[model samples]
Target: MQTPPDRRSFLKTTTAAAAGAALTSTIARSANAAGSDEIRFVLVGCGGRGTGAAAQIFNTKGNVKLVAVADAFAANAERALKSLSRGENESKVDVPPEQVFAGLDAYKAAIDVDADLVIIATPPGYKPQQFEYAVNKGRHIFMEKPVATDAAGVRRVLASVEESKKKELMVAIGLQRRHEPTYMETIARIHDGAIGDVISQQVYWNGGGIWYRNRTADQTEMAFQTNNWYHFNWVCGDQICEQHIHNLDVGCWVKGMYPVECNGMGGREQRMGGDASKSQIFDHTFCEYTFPDGTKMFSQGRHLAGGWNHVGEHVQGTKGTANPGGWIKGEKDWEFSGKKVNGHQQEQHDLIEALMRGEIYNEGEYGAHSTFTAILGREACYSGKVVKWDELLETGTELAPGIDDFTIDSEVPVSARPDENGLYPVPVPGKHNPFA
Candidate 1:
């Protein structure tokens, strides 16, 4: 019955209360004489990725503290917290057993605590609702990449973005590539026409790794797993929306707008284990998305790990092109190669600086826009037809429910819905909001 934080209030604070001298050194909060401006945190997920973010915060200035922690499993959360405390995070974490909230509503318990920052590090399936609450509370957020798994989850995030802008809140999404200086500088060149008139481009995410599947018998259906979120179409919305979203986000960064349309094709020819619990996501997918002005971008995401195809992006232009992941081309043969840049740190550092500076930063918009671009690729792959962005988004078919309340079959698409074979939901294109 509680209305979430006002997005406008969230947006307004970014420029107001946050920009003082305390924010000057964004990487680490400089300890003050009084040590007063404490940025307490509540980590919602304890997976490797979530732990990585927690560690980053530790390496950063000790201005913020990990006060409380939560997860689906108490052991996992405590493990992560203990690891942090034993290592560099000992001085920062003050969470007692009682403060360590767990279970489905763990996210809520963490956010409701007295804290300055909220790290929404859970699965993509649970992002919208927690993010919504964090915004309402006017908390600074360090959210992971790929904001949502489907269009419906996205619509709510889009709304949240607008509210964040109005409130001046500093919202950092997980897409760390955008914060990297090399990538930012390179993109500026492309926009400056260094590559001449831009044309279509190609990008890839390929390699070898373990296959995604259902959890073992010991885990409940609600128990979380990395591979499970990867396979469940409703949860991960196919590889295109989940992993490949980074490339799609880059495509949006290059095009400077949400894609106009996408046509894609995919097949689950591999990874045919019977343990695929209600999961029918693709093993591989290739999509072509066009911008409003007719600029084209091609994306190829392959799951056949350890293959000859390495990962990168190629931007074609009359003057030549630049490939992300450190490849490049030129018209008169002008060329420059880059060493691998650490993007995660770049984005994290930027967020720290933004928070300290109290700059008006919000990932809600850019993240939502880029995520929807990724979903366009998924919708196209599922429907077997070319889909227009304006139309697909118009249906208001949210993948994750706007709210977190779920009662057995509570009509929430954020996670999954069983198919005839007892598999989770697949994208039903014709339906108004199949995921929800």
Candidate 2:
């Protein structure tokens, strides 16, 4: 059986090859060839988001089709294919059973197909590695965010961003809010001083809890954890990175820079006292981020039910306060009264448009920075210490070590065996070093 390419080779080849510029130009010409401008795509990580992205790509203005599908499980890939085949853009779904791949190495099989683009919607932990491989192969990509789950992964993504630019690959991150017309218009005005000198900001994703994947007795530890990845810190990067990144990205966007430092607190309160394997991650986090100019941004993310459900970004400036969702109050009181497009679908539309125009819209760098911002908040909450931007970026912490070599029988990187009371060990602030 064939295995995924080793990480060393992937990194070495990507670093050694300096043909990004030329390869990008070649891809542009090939994609835009007269009367043959068909954009073929392979969907990696056949989850709801992945399949949705495939369908959205077909919705774009082009002859786009889903040529292949890949997932960690065969069942998931089949479900995704079936879902796409029955969608409004069913004509674009062309992945035969043989073309649908499953297993840890399934992404390589999908990427190997003759396709113009690849959509990576896997768990954030797997993104950096998969993204590097796709870039090395000179493929245009549409990857979901948060782009990575850790500082180490962020480093790899940042490097890929530069390489993609050199090769001119059109890479778009799943920070879909960036494509929302309301947000775009509002932020444009904020940048134009409609919000005056930004003084403070607040971002949130506090909402109800997420679903839990019950572990089957027949499954291995690895299978169980991978199935319930969102609960695992190594795989999901915790709730802060997984879901709250959307709000955090908006905060950074409003400030026009990443945070300089972060300090926060979090704990697994509501979803606790369960089987160790089932409830390991926290359900709530509150972070205070400081930008370079001493600007402060208060961020809060929680999954507890019926407390408060605010999921937007608000920036307060010297003159006015602006909501990135298309509203402003105080000196420049205005509300977004324009038409709204589905930002989720708009992200794909913009990406395909850039491809057709031969323009490289690589969001890799910004994606990494935003992802790391979440990591900083997580590390702060986990370690009970203030984490500086530079130090966290330089940490050798590798969440989900040996993820590149995962197999059905592989051991789970985090061992969350239940205690006598069937409870898991949650992060205790000031008890252990999370960054270590």
Candidate 3:
């Protein structure tokens, strides 16, 4: 069995190699060369989001080309390529049939292709390994958030961030809200004291539901779970880390700090037709996160249908209150009336523009930290205990142990098979040990 590479050992080896060679100058020259020519990129996970991201890259103002693409299933890769080759995106996409890869190890082959950027939109559990590989290859990255499915994964990304900085790689995490004009203006005001002395905050991702894929007779357990990754803890990190991360990230952005400690409660209800066996995740979670200054942020995320739903962030300070989406209701009320742009598209533009100008920006560190914040909240909810940030990060269980060795036929930690009572082992609040 092969586990993830140890961060310390990897860093030690890479650092020693870097010192012996002109790696820094060589990478700088490569980035400069890319700026002058068409920036070639590869897509590692060709799902809907990955395909959309590749489209956005084509839409970016640049001489850019898609060189390769990969996915866990060959169908998805073919479909994404077909979709991208239609109409306007056709000329921009140049991936041949030979460049299309499938299976668990497909990401490595895609990354090994001749490309300047790697777009990683795989399941969160695989992100750490993929990111480390990209950084080692000295490729700029744009990976979707949340970055990881567990604390161990978070630590892995954090370690990779350092190496990326040393390589001057431009990394972008898909927390697109940070790139939106409305959010950028509104958060700037909050930071500038429009909402004076931030004291408390609230964020949400309460929604109706998400899609579920039924197991097919031909599919193995690993393939089934990978296809329907959201319901499993080891891959998706539940709804909190997946869907709710946007709001939680906004909360942290507004406060300008990550939570020091958090205690949360969550349980599965009204999910998978009310059958616990179908999902290993909670449909609803409420978390109270405390900052170092004693200020608190309250978080609510639910997937239950027919409930009052909200999907935004709010900050309450000494002088006033604000909605980070676009407005402030403080001493002097204000609303944004600026030119609005699609954040999803804008983020790609920023990355491309920055690379062309030779300005390297690495969003990986903050992105990893915010991701860990969500993981902390999830663990707190699972264990029904106050989970401190440092403790959980340093010594939490690896959700997908020996993840690098996983194949379509390999066994997942959480079994898809049901017990005699036809129930899966959903986490019990008092008994679930996230650290074990």
Candidate 4:
């Protein structure tokens, strides 16, 4: 494995002086206030993952406080706040009802509050906009994975990454596997030649099914889709980008490069009782990705019940084989025997510690690129044609145009109404124009 480049070397000389001065000031303040000063943060999107991330932050060593919270729904924000205001986290949380915001634009209010960090766990569709806002505010960020739902959104995130680096802000994405001790040890060895020259890989996120929320009689089309985001393409990007991205990301990490081309097949096999009206996303996908080095990665992602279930990655190398999560199977086999840690919790710990040390590390670039990789596979499966990284990224359709101005009463980009047969339109291979 090649030695990782020093992050400082990539700093722009034009901004080097300013960045250096900022870093020095930050280091001194952080070092002096380590355990004394409060590190306040705001939460945007009070869903399950958002709540969990807040809990982890409270567990970190420091004087951290949850200053504000926001969600598309008021109930979600309230519920998350109630959950956090229990046991050990209760004292650390300072959010009052006034600071708990709701509605599509609520994130702006929460982010506007005085805070050192912002945690974004919104649906993938909302991430790019929210992330750009956080960076503009000059707040550190800890955002969830699959940074975007479409190539357009990925482009937006990539742009924000540059601004964040210029400001020397610390940005951590929720690809927690990179922070897991076991995965770290195993991948380090792979890069060190334990799994010499990875040739092929197999990754899977095959699972049973996901939760579905029935549209209530009083709910608007936008409300209904937001409630059941997992079933929508505009918001969720299907299961491939939503859930299967982790495994695909591991494949890319082992190869140290993104796939150049991909083709695949997928459809809504057993989803919503085979009714397309209820869901616009595919339930199963099989993607064949070709890396720039000509290596292939066979990817599988399924949501059908009673099928084989798997959620890991495997790699084949010239000199050996490896399960990048922890083990190598050739040229002196080895296993990770380190203390197992919860990646979700560990990631928070790492971010907070690095902030105290004033060390800036931005994961946004790879996060956006890996997300686009998943989008590439999804497009291939949807179009039933080979898709190249550059072409799709340059011409792919935006999943939600004018997303920055969305409101609760705004019409959704994808219709929720059913056809005469009570079926929603599902993407048909060979007919879907991914770049349209």
Candidate 5:
């Protein structure tokens, strides 16, 4: 398809605008002082990310225990259970054969278990409602990133955020970049203006592509979307929210605030009409985020074949620029900007300790803002124009396909042709782009 003029210009201006928007936002963190110990956990999603996170949480000390498991697929739940450490500590798990749940309401099944904490590791589409359920039941939570696929879902998460704080529930989102010590130290320095007045930053997460392959004849869009939830817009919120959200979160962390507006571009670069099931989400997205203090974040993410060696953050100022790992370069030349950096292990362990010590802790509001920062940039890239964070914050577009019944016919198409005219809704802002 020929490049549309509107789209072309949108891409061009976005690049220029990014020259000054770096490190304008940092994730707001809340870690209450240590209190009395004892916290149990229930994992809702059991895919690789979920299981891997479970492992990290396990390594955390101070009265933390995994108790239950739940997934839409039986195999997923079983996989999570099997991968966990088996000992007297893990032996008290509430998930036996009868306790493991598989179904649309698997989260409820897991939440119904006798546990004090829950992990919403399922697809983002279900995160809001599941989180609400967990919060209502009064449980501390450790949810994966991309809080919700759409604005309303975010609203739901925000609602839960309020209640969880009221109950003093310990809620942590799995934006592990916050846990990566190298980035943390670098960000602290940037905030301290070690590089002088911050000017801009460039963050990229590009690769040859991730799990987007053809589905067999036996697989339907519904089945494929549910199983490969990370690739579905309604489920994972695209690469921007799923993968790039990390970079966005880093931007938020470095800037010490949230972006006010964003402009971007995204499309199905490699997989257009091949098959709806193979890949239904945008493969690449480039966005310019303008934060409250006029800092810029040149955020970019791509899954194209043979792309750049990626996955890092760079904060720039009048003095220097550095990757999250403390690699800094400027007129003074490259200098390792080592600071106090900690990984997910330490972060989770600290949170658990805080919980045990009865310290105030909550990942609700701060995590939501960071998650939306990524989502807003995504909406910009999707629509080929700037979008206000306010609009995104109140957006009601829902990608959550609440399918009551799953069958081949009930599947949502993931890919399509733009027709002979090469036309499709490309996430334009403010006019109710109803293409979802």
Candidate 6:
């Protein structure tokens, strides 16, 4: 993707000093209170996204360094280090071999280093626990989203958000759309009634399935499960929570709150045969979420190949309709012709800026809410029942059971139990109850 001219201008012209010129008195004071001229950061997950985030942080307009890295597997950390040390971000790598740790408990050792910021980019199952630990250590954070696989994890993240505020730690969540200039401008107009009252909304992330890791002979059950976490409900939270959450989040942002209730249905249409023990997740989910104002959001996600793929949001209002990421039609017709910076990079830009300005920036609550929103839709689909926000959060169902104390030989939360010939248990509308 080419960088938009406007985005280039913003990145080129908006230096910390330039941005500070228009800061409020409070923000200016906060900026002056910034603790250090050099900021050291650590990464908890050394996957592709983590490496990309580190590159973005290095691109930020201030003194920054990638000091340490941790991962569930040593191979991933080694890959990230090699990649980071060879490219344009090579100068930013200061992590000694001793600073790079591996294993399930590696994050704690990395977080204990003298660092100002920590990037929690691990799988969703470990996000809440890792994020909570980062907050407790008083380190600023840039965490990936859907922050958790279930509501129990969402509560922990929400609590961490409050604690972050009290500690004045800058926390940025990877809902990259919210950081995009076009999304910000368009959503602001919608909120200002540019498209009148939003009557209905549609969001989607219908596309092909993600990569599947083949289990090796030496890999233990827990190792294989952790390596292939995407196929397990205890880790990835199904397709809805893992990938479709981005679109669902846009719906919630447009509504200014999470949905009140959701009734949905989903199933595994394409996944079949072979090693049935490898997966326990659905490939498709359809949900109808009702916001507090009675507005309805229809959402659908599928992973089947050779199907129509649509990955965007459409909002229909009384006066007109709008594609919040693009343009509006009807009475308030407008288009976002702005220069585009990469949403991924822009999120890091905003976070670094907030930290530099000493202004309080916390996306924990919003991230958790959007994550819960995804979970609500999944729960509805999973159990084939209407799921309410309040009740869902109180279910206290923890995915990845005993994850906090798991060794390579530990039993997985959900066994790959097959019936008869070979077929893992799948959600069957009225037959399966995820919450129960």
Candidate 5, residues 1-436: lDDT per residue as tens digits? 0111132332232221111111112212222213324466788988887887777777666556677788887877887798785665464354668788887677887898767667788888778888999988877778888788777677778888888767667677777666555665556566556777677888888876676535567865566667767666676778888878888777666666667888887777674443443455777888999876677899888888866768877787888777766655655444454455445565567556555545545556656776777777777776676778776665535554453333334646333223345342233334434233
Q: Rate the local accuracy (lDDT) of all candidates.
A: 0.66, 0.79, 0.84, 0.83, 0.66, 0.79
Show where candidate 6 strays beyond 4 Å: 1-36, 272-275, 415-423
- In terms of lDDT, model 2 sits at 0.79
Better of 3 and 5 by TM-score: 3
In model 5, where do residues sit more than 4 Å from their true spots?
1-38, 85-94, 213-220, 272-277, 328-342, 401-436
Higher-scoring candidate on lDDT, 2 or 5: 2
Tens digits of per-residue lDDT, candidate 1, 1-436, equal: 0111232432232222222321232323222213466667778888778888887877665476788888867777888888878855688888888888777678888888887777888777678777888888777788886778766677778788677656656678887777664566566577667777767878777655444454576665545333366666555666776678787777666655556788887766554543345455766778888776687899888776445565666788788778654434564433335554566665666666555444535666666777777788877776667877777776635554543664222453534655556665444444423223
Give stretches of model 4 more than 4 Å off: 1-36, 414-422
Q: Tens digits of per-residue lDDT for model 6 on 43-134?
A: 99998789899888888996788889999899999899888888677887899999999998899999999888899998898898899999
Worst lDDT 10-window in candidate 3: 15-24
Name every residue pair that clashes in candidate 2: 20-167, 21-166, 21-167
Instruction: List TM-score per model, in order.
Output: 0.84, 0.90, 0.92, 0.92, 0.80, 0.90
> Cα deviation in Å at residue 384, candidate 1?
0.7
Candidate 3 Cα outliers beyond 4 Å, as residue runs: 1-29, 32-36, 414-422
Model 1, position 277: C-alpha lDDT score? 51
Give the root-mean-square deviation of each candidate in angstroms: 5.9, 6.7, 6.1, 4.7, 8.6, 6.6
Give model 6's TM-score versus the native structure. 0.90
Error of 5 at 15 (Å): 30
Model 5 superposed RMSD (Cα): 8.6
Better of 1 and 4 by lDDT: 4
Model 2 residue 397 distance off true place after TM-score fit, in angstroms: 2.1
